[model samples]
Target chain A: MLNEKEKHRYSRHLLLDKVGLQGQEKLKAAKVLVIGAGGLGCPVLLYLTAAGVGTIGIIDFDLVDETNLQRQILFSINDIGKNKALAAKHHLEQQNPYITIKAFAEKLTSKNALELVQQFDVIVDGTDNFSTRYLVNDACVITEKPLVYGSIYKFEGQVSVFNYNNGPSYRCLFPEPPKAGSVPNCSQIGVIGVLPGLIGTQQANETLKIILEIGTVLSGKLLIYDALSGNSTSINIKRSEEQIDKTKAMKPHFASFNYDAFCGIDLINTIDITELKELLKSENIQVVDVREEWEQPRINELNALIAPLDDLDDFVNQIDRNKKVVMVCQRGARSLQAILHLKKEYGFNNLINLEGGLLNWK
Target chain B: MKINVIYFGMIAEAIGKNVETLQINSIQPNTDDLTTFFIQQYPVLKNKSFKIAVNQQMATNNTVINENDEIALLPPFAGG
Candidate 1:
């Protein structure tokens, strides 16, 4: 079914025994939906487009931020402030005129996830949040679509394939989302710019394999790549019957699933920097710095107690339970952990974690 | 029993090292025991969420670990 132009365009693929003209036609017939237009999404979109996937749908509500230039290779300075999905679509169209790219410049909510994902053969998760990730996984499970998952943090990245051939889903690997704000993202802790590129390329490879039915896919394996040490580890994952049953039970009413609530991201024990500044004016309040001593740019204005996270147990008795306690760290991650420990172990309910920590303090 | 443990991502940051060897007093220790031992030794990990992989396989708390087995602690990463 390949035209003369199509044959020449995919000459390299035609030459390969694994991906000959037949496989190229399969690529042309495939439809993939990629979620998020961030780092991992950038590379996945690029490779998928170049590989001549027939129809690609991109869903992202975020605009192109100045910070994304480092790794989001689809955008340039001119694309800043534009909608990410639209910008990526324009760039990808220029990269390959033979393929079709659909851009949805809106958030993929529980209402739209099922409808949108059902149209695509594969769902690619490039999102950077627990809520969206869980939503995507559930939607894929409900729709019976394979998901190509990728995530990065600091110098490490993780890649996996979920809901493929009745294989393990993301929930099978991570049964529950980590406590909100307990894990710092790239914005909080920095990630090496190249890490996502490597992981995203692997995700693209998995997608191709799934489409071509050639090599073994990462269906029940987690690939952990550490950029710092140049080490790669593969961890085998097992399917959980309980998680599969949970997904099936929610399939009938998938529209009502509240992913944010499921991920426990709606924080009740958090105070913004502005509110903390106002609270500082009052008496009987203590601002505790839980960061390590080596952490920089101390907050002298708060007269904080340097309780450092590892040494928190030693300072627990010294903290005043009657007074309002505010825990802080470099970012909000460790502070949230400290607050959880204090509330759970010490029975201190008078504690709050700084929402954005010192990074947001003016 | 001596076991080799590896930590990844934020778990490595909290543990201060990527890999280590520990001597467990029990001849056959379960993942829950190893988790408890690590939490007691590295209190910073008490509140952090991570999954344990025994010999490159996902491990449940009840999974028994043997001597010379390789265990890894993998923390969740939401960054794309």
Candidate 2:
């Protein structure tokens, strides 16, 4: 049944013992949607396209930035400032003309997640943030589609398959998001250039595996990889009945609500370094670092003090009532918490929570 | 009992390796026993967020670990 051109194009794949002509056919028939055309999406798109996947959908609203060139391999210098999904679609179409590539240059809000996901056989989560991750999981759960998920931060990456044939979902693993701003992004901490590539390729492999039904799917299990030391481990997870109940009740409608605030993405109220520098010259602003004693990125300048939040009562007496105060934490949530408490207790009308906290100070 | 312990993330940082063989006194060490062993060996890891995996699978606090089986300590993961 193989044509000359088709056989030649997938010769390497056909040669594999596990993935012969039958497997190749399955791959060709498969329809997959890869969300977020960023770091993880690039490698996922590349491999899926090269593998001759029949239809691949890419969803991303963000344009490529100069900073993204370091890790997002799909974009080149010329591709910078271009919409990521469009750029990835253009390149992937050229890579394999046999496959149908659909590019959706829009953010993956809850309103569109289910509609977009229903068209695909499997959904690959290349998204970088928690809110989108939860949204994708919920959408996949409701649609009964398998989700091939991958994520990267610094030298670490996590891969998992959620809602695979009634298997556990993302909430089964991490029931709730960490109290916001506690975790740092890859942008803030910096990931190894090849880390997302390695992880995304693994995600692509899982996608193919799910399509061809070749090997074991990572359903109900989480795989953690450390690129720095090259160590990998797998953890088995059982479906949490409570989490399933909670997710079942979730009727996600992004059009009705502000997801950034609902999920705490836009929680940062950051003032840039230039602003902080200017504030110091004025002396009207008091910089309060609310990070605990052991937390790093400490500032060693004037007007900055270590007034941790847990012991706010102890520091209440030390407050400078006459000046405007900028509260900071490792990320930002704690600083906001401090500001809320300070304004309530002392009537500190000049209190402002530093956006993005001290982590963004550099 | 000798068990193969697998460490992940910051737990691997605390234990300083991916896998290690540990000999314990009990036949089936409870969660308390395992936590105590790690606390005794690496005190700094007492507060690091983590979960346990038994025999190449994630397990609960009461899940029984056996000899020659793999046990993993995982930290709070922040990926996608």
- Go through the candidates in order and give each one's DockQ: 0.64, 0.40
Error of 1 at A120 (Å): 0.2
Q: What is the interface RMSD of each candidate, in Å?
A: 0.8, 2.5
lDDT (Cα, tens digit) per residue for candidate 2, span A126-189? 8877667877887887788999988776788889899887789887876555435555567776
RMSD versus native structure for model 2: 11.2
**Interface C-alpha RMSD, model 1:** 0.8
Task: Give the runs in model 1 whose Cα sits over 4 Å from its true position.
Answer: A267-362
**Candidate 2: clashing pairs of residues:** A236-B58, A269-A355, A270-A355
DockQ result, candidate 2:
0.40
Instruction: Sort candidate 2 into its docking category.
Output: acceptable
> Which one is best on DockQ?
1
